[model samples]
Target: MATQQTSAAGDAHGGTDTSPERWVVGVDGSPGARAALVWALAAAARAGARLELVSTYPADFYWTDPYLLDTVRLDEIRADTAGLVRAALAEARRDPALAAVPGAAEVPTDVVVGGGAAAAQLVEQAQGAQRLVVGSRGRSGVRSTLLGSVALHCVAHAPCPVVVVHPGAVQPPPRVVVGIDDTDVSREALREAAEEARRLGAELEVVAACPLEVVWSNIYSVVAPPAEETRARARERAEIVVAEVLGADAPVRLRVEDGEPAEALPRVAAGAVLLVVGSRSRSRIAGMLLGSVALHCVVHAPCPVMVVHPQPARAAGRPAADPAAAAAR
Candidate 1:
């Protein structure tokens, strides 16, 4: 079994009852990880949710063979991981944004250290969490345009919505942006984005992109529709989606762009506080693969990206996996 430790910060509401809504964050002592911790802290404070900080080390390092185990090495790794989480929590608590929120400094927190693949450990910790936050990249990250393996895995497998925060993402104006299309997942994304915007008291912007190049042909010289007509039709479709999801009188600003969705979304959401996108997958197997637009926004967006998955139906009598057992592997 995996060694574990837990701690709680002072109560935020002057009570002992822990909030049922929990937000789990992965900490790896990297700048990106620290950014994610800070974002999660602020979000938890706003929502009055309990916060859990998790860190992990590779179990393979301390497992010499099927029968032999390096107990001393495993202990050292656990201790180091615990220390890293503690430091991150302390630093995040001191953030001005978190402190700005009422009682944010006193938000309850827990720390967990496990041994296994970092992504699996995080997914295990976030089993019942309201949201899972991870950095777009970690210590092993190389290019800025690429997401780290752990973040990608968590986004694909976490049971709840996943928020990926880039290390250099700045605090933008109070606005939430969401990309939408004719798909059902996009409607879910719009709803999630509207709710988030309401929670943050931010303006909501619904964006739809139409790639006109798809209408053009190379061999037959097919004449594409006029740009204005194409844009008008695109706007109409977006408006219909917005009206269906959020009513006709919903307070949302809609934008129709004449370009690829992957490129237009990030450009339009340049300074927004959060960019909401939906995963175009229905089952767990398909969930492992993100749509091209969603994957692009997560990697290239200038603000925190929230990838909302359609809630899956719960399986009756399904047993939950043991995190400790998973860590021990």
Candidate 2:
């Protein structure tokens, strides 16, 4: 049985309470979702956490299909979907990597079918789960613009940390990379990333994309340039940020580069088990339009990315600071 524990309230978005024994994953038969299923099974085995394969048929999937009026056919489709989910579990059982992990065979698997949006269902189940994993479409700039909608929503709203995996990601005991800045949000991002690294017995790499010197600023045409010592001090400050915010003793390698965050992050992300960053909070007006960097990474990294936001500190309390407020400075 999946271990029973009280989950954080944010768990309404698939964030579940995690201990040594409880883990849950949302799955569908999509290649990406199947990959997530396998990943979850392997993680469950290694951590001795219970696993659940949640498959949802969102109302939208049927919006364009009129055959649903045929009850018999609808029933058949549901049965077929259930079979596919079962097959995925069986495949996980046969995987060599899963078998090699200690106590994997003892891991329990569950299949749940829900009627709602995929993001909503997944997040609901995430309550009480240690972490949530999903597969990505592997799209990037220009050619495919935005992240897959489901992934975007899940990352933005998940109650617990979410892992959006890519095909053929490296197995566990891997390095974790987090994009850090001087903001409190980055501190929260670093803390979460460090905790994950510790749990996985992985190394942690902290990276920051420092702004280049304002050589061409219209108002600074006559201003003196920063000294080498000034730049060095900024880098040191970044390292100190990581050291102070983590609140735990863990070795970290810090890197500071000059470039845009969107560009710099991928360079660090290459070949890492996970890349974590904080979500840019949006204003009520802007929110009507789109999210920021955190939303973008949800769909497109070489590896899984965990987008951390400062969860409201109290249950049912207003957020302590504006997500935009954190980003402005």
Give the total clashing residue pairs for model 1: 0
List candidate 2 segments past 4 Å from native: 1-24, 58-79, 138-143, 168-173, 214-224, 227-230, 247-249, 282-291, 312-329
Cα misplacement distance, residue 300 of candidate 2 (Å): 3.5
| Model 1 residue 155 CA deviation in Å | 1.7
Give lDDT tens digits, candidate 2, residues 1-329.
11222222112224432435555566666667766766676666555566666766545555577786565765565566566667777766677767666665556665666556676777778875657777664212222443345565567666666777766456445788898888867777776676656555567788877665556666774465565554576678886786566532446777876766766786667778778988756332323325356655554567778777565452124222222322232
lDDT of each: 0.76, 0.62
lDDT, residue 195, model 2: 60
Ten contiguous residues minimizing lDDT sum, candidate 1: 314-323
**Residues 10-105 of candidate 1: C-alpha lDDT, one tens digit per residue:** 434443546868888889988889889888877776677888888887777454564337677667767777877887788877877675667667
